[model samples]
Target chain A: MSGPIDFYFDFASPYGYFAAGAIDALGARYQRTVNWHAIVLDANFQSLERIRIPSSVMRSDYIRRDVERVASFMKLPYKAPSSLGLHTELAARLFYWFNDRDPQQSRAFAQAVFKAYFVEDRNIAQLEVLQQLCCPLQMTPDDVASVAGDSATRARLKAEIDMAEARGVFGSPFFIVEGERFWGNDRLPLLERWLDAGTY
Target chain B: MSGPIDFYFDFASPYGYFAAGAIDALGARYQRTVNWHAIVLDANFQSLERIRIPSSVMRSDYIRRDVERVASFMKLPYKAPSSLGLHTELAARLFYWFNDRDPQQSRAFAQAVFKAYFVEDRNIAQLEVLQQLCCPLQMTPDDVASVAGDSATRARLKAEIDMAEARGVFGSPFFIVEGERFWGNDRLPLLERWLDAGTY
Candidate 1:
């Protein structure tokens, strides 16, 4: 049996959403398990001395165009969110809580959240918006609130970020299979090749 | 006639070396001329407020691994240069001088330089190393010296860097095919797809 693919992403990243949609099928094809971990990467950016300014003109424009083009090529549905820079703490905490109990349901929850944010252009920053996401997953408002506000869940997510940084994860949609790290969705092909061939 | 593909690179960038090897063929496939431009991207990095620490551990390690893996996957020979951060201005100037005379020879010169610096791990920063490279293209030592020390050649290379920055080029291995910008060697597939489909 192949090793599990450790997939790390920040909840607010569109690239992460895109990778989530594809990584599982990729893992299954290679006889590997895909493990998704939601992490707050603001600290990673801070370490790199990067400022998260929304309108950094040229880069922002290129990223928007790139994401759209990638979605088109992959045939994944995407729409630019109504407002940018929505905080993702609530959504991440809820994910961790679900993942702690039922890993399969948590993956479903993650897909729904990505769909809501990227495809539906819904604001995921709000609890009510996340609460609506729970309905489709057959989860209750109580379950959503229970995890969303859980101190332990929040701490676990924080610890995950620290652990990711320690493991040298600096970008979204980052993957680690059998100790080799691959960054960016663009590297998916290379990652597939790595799995197809035992080694280079 | 199709618009030329503007290929931008920093001479010292490993990824640039890899792209330099592949881009002309890519251009030919689409019936487009590949115009190679070498730029000093320090100013762009400055604009992004980037710090140029030699030992940024993780990123540097990842880049080294990425370049080697990519080279192996592409069946291209590669070796990390003996030293990092070699200045590329002299090479860029000489390239422009040759390019002004014969574009085909200039492409050959660029490949030789990439091989010398990457495969042989030669110090491209040195005049003798560059002079030796000019020999393969049947260029005289005087020709190499003339371009290496020419004020006009220096100005041209500087102008190219400025032009690249104006065109929003912030990274090496950036490509503009028919005015659509593709950044990174990883995007080469998408670029190929765009060429094949005549726009996405």
Candidate 2:
């Protein structure tokens, strides 16, 4: 009953970055395909009437520390984003635009976006920076701008986020295979075991 | 300079039970002693003005599934407690009362308490239930009743929780070794790595 591993993540989540950092390699090792879906996760939380950990709260301080510590533990380079409450919806729309055409190129764009925000400290919400990052993918500035507000891509992203919420994916880095759901990057090891033994 | 691993937990947290199930063995393998400190964790969250995940929220559904799945992954017997928001402050105070006499016996009592709530679905908040759980350690009902609200034990529990908060221990099953803090039971693997090589 195993099919492609569904990887749901949001661009603004550091843990999602960690999952994106290793999930493909892990899938390859297990001879499984990974379907990367970018979601506007906080919107999904709101739709479900769940509380988002506020950036002004004490847990935010721990989240910042945890992100750095986990990045080190995962051996991924990280610089604390100078800004919080990132407008990552634009990035999510672009992801679907690229994903619709070429999944392979979309993965590369996703990694670059993660590094641009986490490692390079770029404001992804800005149109110019995202367009510059896509230049290497052979897209002109105009092509990137077209997807920013195109009705087609906007509907696509909306449908994807809706389906994810319907499936109960309320956390970043949620994975589903054969109808078994695992949430968080920490659950990756257990997911690996499940893939290996079918049930453990 | 690695010293004993200070383990902070509250009896009500399922993740805390998972940590208790394995932390001591993990410590022994590295030639380290584990200093167990039971804390009233939600009080710390309140003092810090952080939102504790309400068990009635939408996220609570995911938490229930995750707890069951984690219990299976840890290979520990579990039965969802019929009660939520357990009055674990009483249990935390009793832990120190016995700990002052014999740390080993205190540890054994702690395990029994965890099993009573997690596996057997017994209400640990009730004094009659808790006193019976400690009977295996040769503690009579009268001796257990004495510690139920002893001012000495209440102050002792308060001091322990305050010290933990002062050191920034906000999550259950938080560990401190040589001043490096690891929160959540999932972090035990990274904590083990640090114990091995002294910094990855």
Candidate 3:
């Protein structure tokens, strides 16, 4: 591969975690650098007109089916996340901190959070639960909390999301390689090929 | 492999056209019968009140990308049709007619209409264009027009669309194999695998 792959993710999304695992394999197979960008999905929705997409029964069904399909394809275990809604700002900010320090660790943290919500059916919204989840990463609770609440870090996170929206991002696990935006995780293979062929 | 694979399709959808070509091959590979059903996409929208998915500049880009992706995956020349939206009712009615008379010919006719609209970019909405395109199928323009205009056939067609909505159809190229709804053309391989494994 002749280019870098930028992966935009949010911890609240199970699909994002699914993409993380597959993306790891992709990085190894193709000659490319993967940059993980943590984004607050709720804040992004807020900026886009407080437009809470009304959850339709049809959409819910689709999500269930899609998660099953991808899990089967990737041969990963998946269950619908128990937590329907969680304030993802803190988790997203912590992701930013991990990305700066260790990208691989950030990926592990992403998977752990997904497992907590979807597979374990735990309520990740509780701060104590989130803190307990971060314990294994060796980052102190105070350190993670302080960074997550920092006004400057929050501003930077918001700026990153604004840039993503401006670049036409509509969903989680969006991949941008050389100005081409592959909106879903399913497009990762195509992205790899495009990179390998050095075609725009 | 032991049973039939119900293929849910909408004539107006380009993805449905792409999937129609290889559905038979997939069915053969898995030793499953592909039961093709014609549906009206617009009717489903009215019943569901689906939010008009914003037409991102990315829509066209994604379509082109998917065309290439699906074509390569199926080893077919996938081209974007120039003439976009065709009155799918005529096509659907024609399909129903041919399906009852000659199943093999019906598949070919469906493929032709799909190619005319998506690949050739011809004005499929125009009767003249449809007539020109239908010539190779050995069906006369009169034959097509007669069946398409029949009130009973139209009623039957409308009923099929109504039934699809009642069954929770949200988009085109949906596959219902043993009651499992696979929504997109991308899921074809997984759909086949599930059938082969007798998981459905």
- Interface RMSD list for the candidates: 5.7, 2.9, 5.4
lDDT of 2 by residue, B1-200 (tens): 56889999889888899999999999999999999999986654444535345545423776777788789889888888988668798888889988999999889889999999989989999999988987888888888888877888888988998898887787787898888888889999888988987874
Clashing pairs in 3: B81-B118, B81-B121, B82-B121, B83-B121
Q: Per-prediction TM-score, please?
A: 0.92, 0.94, 0.89
Candidate 3 residues lying further than 4 Å off, grouped into runs, are A45-59, B44-60
Comparing 1 with 2 on TM-score, the higher-scoring candidate is 2
TM-score of candidate 3 to 2 decimals: 0.89
The DockQ scores of all candidates, in the order shown, are 0.35, 0.48, 0.29
List of chain A TM-scores, every candidate: 0.90, 0.93, 0.85
Candidate 3: share of reference interface contacts reproduced: 0.07
Per-residue CA lDDT of model 3 for A1-200, tens digit only, reads 35778888776676777887788668667767888877766665542322223445224766667777778787777777654656677777677677778888877777777788767877766666678788999988887677767997787778878887776565678888787777667677667767766663
lDDT by residue for model 3 over B1-200, one digit each (tens)? 37677787877676787788778888888777888888876553464546333323214555566566656655565566654455677778777777888888778877887777766777666667667767888889897677777997888777877777777676778888777778778777678778877662
TM-score of chain B of 3: 0.84
Worst 10 residues of 2 chain B by lDDT: B50-59
- Model 1 agreement with the true structure over B1-200: per-residue lDDT tens digits: 36888999888877888899899889888888888888776533444312222334313677778778889888899987778668888988888988888988888888888888889999988899999999978878888888899899988887888787777676778898777888888888888888888785
The recovered share of true contacts, given per candidate in order, is 0.23, 0.35, 0.07
CA lDDT, candidate 3, residue B191: 83
